[model samples]
Target: MRYLIMAEGEGDGELLLGRCAAVEGLFTDPPPPPREVLVLRGCAPGVRAEWLGAASVVGRTESGFEVWWTLVDAEVLSVAPHTGNPALVDVTIGAGVLPDDWHRHADGPFVRFELTTGRGAVRAVTRSATDGLVADRAAAEPLPLRLVGCEPAEPMRAALRKRRGRHPGYTELWSLDDTGRVMDRRAIGFDAEWTRPSVLGGALVDVLLSVDADGLPGLAARPAWRLWRAGPPQRAGSWRELDAAGRHAWLMLAMRRERPAGPDRSGGEYHLAGAGLRDEPGLHCAIGEALLGPGGYYGWGWDALFDSLCGGFGLVPPFTLVWHDFAATERELAGEHDPAAGPGYPEELARELEERGVTVLRA
Candidate 1:
């Protein structure tokens, strides 16, 4: 997939940075997530962790350590001593009690560790690793990125040569297909020095870079993660061309790119190929494709889905959702032993859609 450097911010869409290839970072296996130190202000006095890397203490490290947290049940604020203080880390945790709610702790927990795994947020990661990818390079000038053909506009290139460290930050890079059609857009700040090559024609080729975007790492579940690294599809129906794993990847990529809200199909009937509607993510991928075509963006979670149903995001309400090959599950979408919101997710999903004036046809 080819990529172009567009103007900073989403304001201007016409600007382009020409074409390039052999891009890294965005699609590549992300380096260890930048560690984020969880500062527990107004924490309790006796709060502590069982061990340094304990689940209740440090949480999930970005390096792939695991923890046990669920919606129904709980794992355990399960911390410390990474920096110092070998003192036994003690803490109390309950099922369904998450770290984000650390502030809610009645004892006022003092956080000493961080979830390096970024928890589940691909973008927002833990801070045990300390300095951030971009933050560390803050004082660094120019750019450490070396996109294959990162040729800026003539005017922009001239500016770079005249001023060594002039324009940086919020450098917008748009992933494009072979035909130069934009597939995805990412705005990442360059936190390094950009040494302009002496040659006029030569694009600034100094330093290597990494793209720290969402859904780029820790996707062992999505077998077809490479499908996403290839970038968005040229046309729609991207879901149709995907396998089960690819379907997951499609959702990952789709979640990053926000499709603008426009007029609905005007009370249209969209057919969903619901043959393998196994998980919630799978259902979202198929339904989004059915309504908004390939690489579509309807909503991932319940609250987001409600926003989509309200209107503006592609197909407004009053449309029919023909969910083919439908089958209801006995247990909730959550796994065994985990807390469940209901018996199954389908009924809840249907109830939400129908309430919003959507016609759900289960086939």
Candidate 2:
């Protein structure tokens, strides 16, 4: 039998019927196809639809209307009502914390409650009833995947340079040893047309790769422009609207989302659609790993040999960069090196990171 909840106050009768029981209740006939109605004295607008399906909701209206509703499982006032089955709850709370009066039974870490028990009983009833429907639907496509600790090498540098022009105020140069280790690690040392080096570490000879920016933000912003010229434009974010922090946030979220598979053989192992990195022919680079911290997140691109180093090191690597500024620390450069910069704790830091499954490539 259906449970009809008639409000003792104004508006709640219509409001409850409008919200919980119907999808198009606002304008439907016969009060929007009644399922089970629970009338109350007062009303609460915040009480959601899911809550209605499970158990009673405590709510009040602006005019001092208050009410709660629950399906009836037992006999009530000579009325045909759906029996409101009592709920049972068993929860684990932290030790040493004072037990709240809301729980009926609290022994050690576990607390148990029956639906007809008291106040919490109704909430528990509603929660259990709606759990399946609410939990089944997945959340929105996650924030995009982000590339962290991205360093530009020869191919990326040449690719952007060929796509754009000689960028001033930017430096892009780096080297990888025969074993894929970054060698004589230093930020790129050069003068492009549109940028200038605010800081300098001089240039290295055996440059395996280089890029204009020391961090991923700069790399991400410029790629869109280059990609457009390379062929039909792809869907990379824009440069003009986003700054370093904004770019980093956007890229990090973007990289984590699932996208179509990459056409290239090298990046095809992970189901591209199921993978975080967006798969597009125009993708100029791949993020190998990422780090997160209070300052924020940063991304990095790795070379072809990067996969090997990660694999050899027994790492499931997060994003592409060999190194990164995951916490957004304001250092001289993104991943700048200083042999004599004083060993505050570089060796220890490196060891800790490696132990945590990171392949810390030395500069």
Q: Residue 217, candidate 1: how far off, in angstroms?
A: 7.2
The residue-level lDDT of candidate 1 at 46 comes to: 40
Q: Which consecutive 10 residues in model 2 have the weakest lDDT in total?
A: 15-24
Q: What shift in Å separates residue 194 of candidate 2 from its native position after superposition? A: 48
Q: Highest TM-score among the candidates is held by which one?
A: 1
Q: In model 2, what lDDT does residue 335 have?
A: 30
- The lDDT of each candidate is 0.48, 0.26
Error of 2 at 274 (Å): 28
The deviation in Å at residue 279 for candidate 2 is 26
lDDT of 1: 0.48
Model 2 over residues 1-363: C-alpha lDDT tens digits? 011111123443221110011011111111111233222211112222232222333223334443332232211111122234322222211111111232222223211211221212232222222111111122222111111222334433443354342323333222222333222122332322221121222331111122322222233434332322232213322322444433343344333323334332111121101122222111112222222211111222223223433443222434222433322221322132333343322343345446544455442
Error of 2 at 106 (Å): 20
Residue 53's lDDT within candidate 2 is 20
Residue runs of model 2 more than 4 Å from their true location after superposition: 1-242, 259-330, 333-352
Off by over 4 Å in 1: 9-19, 31-145, 154-169, 194-207, 210-248, 252-262, 328-340
